[model samples]
Target: MRKFTEEVKPSRAVFVKWPLGHPFGEPFKVRQHNAVIRKAFEALKTIKKPGTIIDLPFRWRRDEDWEDKN
Candidate 1:
């Protein structure tokens, strides 16, 4: 994680809740998907400066979900 952070060096980062092969939270599940995105954005809103790493209150079903798209 540290290495990747160093590579990208982003000002802020966002993590979401979902599952492997279902980043958007199951197909057609707009409500759940939106909730995940909203949570991430909510965490972002609390950041008042750069270099913030919000852990997010939610967690994806699996790390593989990180690469999933809908």
Candidate 2:
């Protein structure tokens, strides 16, 4: 993630804890998407360091709901 961010070099980096492809949230989840966007915008306002990476504290799944048994 940092590698790609460094390569692209946006004004500020807002790192969400979602999956790789779902940057904001899942495809059809409006609430999740809004939350993400709101967080990102909030981060954008108060970020001090230029290239600092802020990881949003969120989880895509509950602890016991799904797991790879293998």
Best by lDDT: 2
**lDDT string, candidate 1, 4-70, tens digits:** 5546867776643334456446677566577667656666677778776665444544434333432
**Stretches of candidate 2 exceeding 4 Å from the true structure:** 62-70
Q: What Cα-based lDDT does every candidate model obtain?
A: 0.57, 0.65
Residue-wise lDDT of candidate 2 within 1-70, one digit each (tens)? 6578878877787776556787866677666667667767777788887876676666685322112211
Query: Which pairs in model 2 have colliding backbones?
Result: none
